[model samples]
Target: VKIRVGNGRVKGVDLGYKVIECEKIVVAAGEGSKYLFQTLDIDIPIVIRRKELYVSEPYSLFIDPLIIDTREDSLGLYVTQTLRGELMGSIDYPEAIDDLTHETTLKHYTVYAKKLVRLIPIMKYSTVMRCWSGNYVTTPDNSHIMGRDPEWPEGLYISTGFSGHGFMLAPYTGFLMARHLIYGETPNTMEPYTPDRFRMGKYVRESLVIG
Candidate 1:
């Protein structure tokens, strides 16, 4: 787990360089990456937001495929079947908290779960076994931190702090980020997505339904 310098030879070094050299150094370490970036004097404030995911065992009923109820102006209770007919869901109105722990309270769970059961009726008696948490590192402007740094160390690159949309946009963002760093010629089509805009207050809001 440690990528630091070592006492013995490894990966072409008697010890990893106190300072290494590479064509590029990409910091895509997710929300937890802020601690490392601070070492390089890159001050990024990343918050830990808890998103709850549920796994439930079936009642004497059948629910097939993925049933997502995007109603009530929120991601409401989304129900999806597993290989064994178990269901998973989430309550989408994010309250925005620093509490990453997602020990589901019975009230929150019952309320959201029943919302789906009401819509479909088949899940009326399913028993939820667990609720868990995941983090979505969000930038203040709700975009990703991409592109090469203009000031600090040249050849250094940043690609962290995605505002919950990282997974959906990973491929295209990688292409654009690599092109900008490698050739200094980022496609103009994606120019507006650069992280620099956060400083200028020119923000772009995406109608990503899942959020």
Candidate 2:
């Protein structure tokens, strides 16, 4: 992806074979967002962490609600029964590694199984049939970095560093960001989440990060 930033604004983007001009650009590429902003001399502090998920074999278990067991170490353990009767869940582990790798871990599965069985004894009879991992783009304050850049006011906008809540908060984030971009107005609720909050020493803290 080619970014074109100049004259205190974004000129356009060169999509390899094509160049599309736009009045502004919003960088929300998750973990890849860091490098994209770097082209415009903007540094966003983000770390990529891999979180693994597991799915159990289909069974006739009546687990309807999403079960979540919060802990201080692993963030929390959560599981829910899908319509197909399969148990799907994930646990937030430590940030020991940094990379965009989809590698699964036997240790993660083992711990999840133990926690699942303890939380719901019926899960002891379940067996995991699949496991996968994905990248999480996290920020220092565990909150998102949104809003226009002060230096590039006429061009760049950012909406990344969501930690692990991007999927759940997409609808709300999209609405707020769109309003900010088109109307040049931001809701007071999102003022604390501006991209330059860290630089201005006004970082907001979010503690309910459940992967």
Which 10 residues in a row give candidate 2 its minimum summed lDDT?
A: 92-101
Error of 2 at 167 (Å): 2.2
Clashing pairs in 1: none
Clashing residue pairs in all predictions, respectively, total: 0, 0
Runs of candidate 1 exceeding 4 Å displacement:
1-23, 58-75, 82-84, 93-96, 100-108, 209-211
Q: CA lDDT of each candidate?
A: 0.64, 0.82
- How well is each residue in 129-181 modelled by candidate 1, as lDDT tens digits? 87777777776666677765465455556687677778878998888877876
* Deviation in Å, model 2, residue 98 alpha carbon: 2.9
Q: Return the clash pairs for model 2, or none.
A: none
